[model samples]
Target: MSLRTRLQGRFQLMAAALVTVVQLPPVLWLCWLTRTPLPALAALGVSWPYLKQLQSPWTTTPRAPSTYVALGWWSACLVFDVLMLPALLAIRAGTPADATWGLAGAVALLLGGDAVLGRPRLRRRTVRIAGLPPELDGYRIGQLSDVHCGPHVPEEKVAGWVSRLNGLGLDLVTVTGDLITHGSSHVEAVARALGGLRAKDGAYVSMGNHDYFTDGEQLVRELERNGLHVLRNRGVVVRRGEARLYVAGVDDTWTSRHDLSRALAARPEGSPTVLLAHDPDLFPQAVERGVELTLSGHTHGGQLGVPGIRRLSLARVITEWTAGLYRRGRSWLYVNRGAGTTGPPVRLGAPPELAVITLRRE
Candidate 1:
């Protein structure tokens, strides 16, 4: 095999081993504390269908049963680490056990409910752009990102998102990558479902890191075949009466296919522009390029957050521009929390989002 392929294989093995190590200890501890093997046995039973995923994280299709088990296990572990463990420590330190357990239970239930039952909601935001053409001032764009369609995220869910976006009467629609979870198996189905998106200027897409995990080229072809424009380091211009708007997209940055300079090379100078990049880390570069607005969605808003706080999320550890809107100078960035899930198929405080952004003249 090629060196790159070999390296990828080795990396997947290491990741699988790491996840196994991290996930095993909590279950073992639970069994020990409970003085029974039932917990351990039950964990094994639930994980059995997904055992192949441990060794090959990117190869297996996620099913509902395994998906639920994975979500439940992740929630349990999170509760244990964040709440249960602390409560147990307090109980050992002469604290009242009743109060501690009660609080832990309440918080756990709240978190669990939000993770499993929360649905994607519509988010509306208006961006003021300097030099925006009067004709283009009220331009509306609908964004759906990271809709990881596969076994876990069914095609039906994607179709529903498309229907909702269509109802918004957007001028343009953009999907900022992570179109499928891993393999090429679901690419056609996802593309077909997303084909239902309706907009005056049509839908545009950008590649994300996860899209490259399998056959990135095939995904691109499928998306294009279904009438979606996959912008790979390129752009297109749309006109609104006398005004012109330039829309462009670059490939996934993680795979090094992104070429911001090339993507913007064909743009008419000083024309209002919007860029679709999968990773928000490219925001700084986009701002430097004078992009009026950059849309992105790779962080998934950390897939968890505090209810009242938008900035506080697990994604903050990876990026300051975790979710929502960010600005620097005259440029703006809006990172969608995405319309689907990956890994455990669970969402908490940071629910999935379908963003309808309106651009107005400054």
Candidate 2:
């Protein structure tokens, strides 16, 4: 293995060890204080799936229902520690045993319900583009990103999303990336589900980091076979009577295939353009190129947040462009919160989203 890969593996191991150290001690102490082995056993049970993930990390696809439950439980415990640990320390007085369980239960139920039942909801936005063609004005495009169709997200769910998108009567549909989580196992299923999507133009897709993780070429073939256009550093023009709208997509930034110049090379001069990039970090570049609208989704809106104030999300620590609309002069970027979960399959404040964006001439 390369030195960088080795270092990353070692770092992952250390991080997993740290998580175990931080999370287990409190649960074990509580179990000891209560003189009950049940909580301790439950903790271990919930942690097993997560531990397996650390062991194999990239290869093990979490498919079991119990695995999801365990993951949810583990996430709840982490949240509990973050919220209660400080309060427990400040009080000095021992917390009632029942209260501890009650709080844990409540956290688990809330987080679990949000993760399991909080389906993607449609969010509508209107963007005014400078010098947009009259025929292209009010062009509605549906966007989906980070669908992550795998163990946590089933084909049926994707089918439902397609049905909903189809009902919207969009002019076009675009999926930003992260179509599959781990392997080729669910690629066909997701492709087939997404194929049901219908629009006046067509559906376009860009690659994401996770898509490259498992047989990206195969996934592309499957998606294309199902009638979705997979844009890899390419642009295409769609016509509405006399007006032309240019839509372009580049491969994911992480995999080193993102060539913005190549993607835009074929663009007709002065044609209003929309760029489909999986990472919103490319927004600056898109702006420099004067791309009218950029659509992306990799943050998953931090997958956790406060409802009204999503800026407080933990995802902010990772990226300044965490979610929602961003504008720089005439260029605009919209970051979808994503339609599925990744690591723990749990969402707190940030719900899954399907965005319907309409373009208006400024």
Among residues 3 or more apart in sequence or in different chains, the pairs in candidate 1 whose N, CA or C atoms overlap within 3 Å are none
Query: For every model shown, what is its TM-score relative to the native structure?
Result: 0.85, 0.84
lDDT of 2: 0.82
Q: Best by TM-score, which number?
A: 1
Task: List per-candidate RMSD values in Å.
Answer: 3.7, 4.6
Off by over 4 Å in 1: 1-29, 36-51, 62-70, 76-113
For residues 260-349, could you state the per-residue lDDT of candidate 2 as single tens digits? 999999899889999999999999999999999999999988776665576887678668898899999999999999999776677766
- How close to the true structure is residue 135 of candidate 2, measured as C-alpha lDDT? 91
What is the Cα-based lDDT of residue 338 in candidate 2?
Answer: 94
Model 2 ranges with Cα > 4 A deviation: 1-45, 57-62, 65-69, 78-117
**Lowest-scoring 10 consecutive residues by lDDT in candidate 1?**
14-23
